[model samples]
Target: MTGYRRVLAHLREDVLGVLEPGDGLPPERELAIRFGVARMTVRRALDELATEGLIDRLVGVGTFVAYPKRNIHVQLTSYTEEMTRRGMIPTATVLDFGAVAASDHVARQLRLEPGDAVLRYRRLFYADGQPMSVDENFLVPQHVPGMAKASPPPSLYRYLSEEYGLVIDWGEDTIEATSATPSLARLLTIDARDPLLKIERRAYVGRVIVDFSVSYYRADRYRLSVPLQRPRRAQQHRPVLRGR
Candidate 1:
């Protein structure tokens, strides 16, 4: 007799492993027949998978594999470029923007004096209509006069290059994990205390700090990916045997 474990193993290897989000699972009767098991056994296996967040069960609808979290490259790029590379439509909402005195933290990142006038802006980044991150950025106003205007350009980096002849040649990024704030929870559609990935970036042109940004991304929906390579060693002319 085929037990639920056998059915589960087969499904995990054949169906769940290959299926993408929104891909429907076969009916319980079909799975039972395919696995040579009772229908009850098939249901039990699916129930366990649903509890593990690997699949979703909808009333009057078949089960489906859940979407895995998206992995983003850890390189310096705009949100628009990243989301576009993932085949998702990217958009941003300007939550807040105005001239504000720099906080101690912002001042340190931007190399400005405390309480110095700087432009502070907040934007909500989206991928395929789902909120992905919230960014709070600060910048000195002396270089980019167009920033003082009421409306912001679609792409901040593009705007800086086109309008001010400035470019982000290099940057420093710091990453950490933290709990979501109330506003962040609401905008990110996650629980108040859920884990979030915080990124602090300082973009620079030559020796000048152009922009400093603090961003929070949903941990459950986003992940950072990086490539690793082994360093090459110097050539060894001859191998000398050491004491065993």
Candidate 2:
């Protein structure tokens, strides 16, 4: 990376440790002098930070730290169940449902022809009357024919298992940081360059892959929690508890 890029990364990490709303960043000239770079280079670094939602630049005033993000947990459960458990009213707006030719990645995940038809289900999810995520799902049409015609139940997994006798054995999921696309920004009411959590997941039933879902979660609204493994020695050790 260039010196300016390095300076930007350092600033991002440093601010992340101590940032609060209304806190001002160092002056652009000062930043340039501190990093031994040009003023334009410092400006570019700040611009990058602004795009990442870490800082906000004002015309007359200096830059300030943005608000801290909301952290949400992600678990392997029906969306209905997850939202209800979190004490939020969950609502869905179906965007589209139809058969489409699967991309190479989707086809490989579903173990089908490279261009085989797959049923696509796209929906926007809301929590507490706020848009929280966009979910796009793909599935093998042969396994669930006429699913688009069927009135979708409250939860997709529940309907699949109950109506089709398909038992979802497990799922593999991945999460990472990404910038919101222009259209997605409009839908979520966020800046197009804001960071977001992108999740790609594939669920399986026995040996067959049942569904693939790509979900984009608002970085300020969602987080994932994963259980960590305990050491074997710790598990073997006994703990004494006093009677209540």
Candidate 3:
């Protein structure tokens, strides 16, 4: 094996196996001396490890073991539920909440006319004390009365299910990559213009649309896992020649 590959294997199996997340690894010079390789060789190995999400290299700070990314499966689940399932404590802080007149886009999503009242709320969600995402939601007011007056709950889906008997049967999500704005970056505790995962969702109960929401998640902390299936092949049909 090459010097760098040997170093990489040793780091992965020996060093990282003994180290916990956020624990700092030895300096490049020390590692190179121990492995009998050049410092650049050691660096190459570390670079590959970083690319594989096994470690994080901070400028002027040093390298440390990286925390695992949270996986968001393609399933109908609330943020609270998803985090709880992964054994993380989920919490939410309501940034803003009140009744508001629906705009043209929101009205269409909720199947209501423009100027109709809707409960609008913005929340910052955390998992295990780390900021995860910011969510802005619009709900059809008639279905969830008094939600605006009361303190917003940690889990909107849970609150809807228990208080109003409004269970979300299914939801559709549109996901894309976006850069965080200055205000959003501050709220999410991330650097300005950092990459973010944007998700827009419309949730329904039976045939009625009840919720429209947009969420932005830190890309480094979260990833989406989707299962895909191959399409079936279409059967070929032969054309018959007509006799004159």
Best lDDT among the predictions, by candidate number: 3
| Residue 233, model 1, lDDT | 86
The digit string of per-residue lDDT tens for model 3 on 34-80 reads 99999999999999999999898988889988877897676657777
Sort by lDDT, best first. 3, 1, 2
lDDT of 2 by residue, 130-241 (tens): 8888988898987887787887556787778778887676677777899999999988878898778998878877657889988888877765666555558636422211
Cα deviation at 90, candidate 2, in Å, is: 0.7
Best by TM-score: 3
Q: Which should have the higher TM-score, number 1 or number 2? A: 1
How do the candidates rank by TM-score, highest first? 3, 1, 2
Q: Positional deviation of 64 in candidate 2, in angstroms?
A: 9.8
User: What is the C-alpha lDDT profile of model 1 across 1-244, one tens digit per residue?
Assistant: 3498887777776555688765899989898888887899999999988776677677786788865567756555667877787889999899988899998999988888999989988889888888888988788999777577758767777778778888777776788999998989999887798789998878877779888988898876777775555556884322111000
Cα TM-score of candidate 3? 0.79
Worst 10 residues of 3 by lDDT: 235-244
Clashing pairs in 2: 72-223
**Candidate 3 deviates by what RMSD?**
9.4
Q: Comparing 2 and 3 by lDDT, which wins?
A: 3
Q: What stretches of model 3 exceed 4 Å from their correct place?
A: 13-36, 57-64, 113-115, 229-244
Report per-prediction Cα RMSD to one decimal: 9.5, 10.2, 9.4
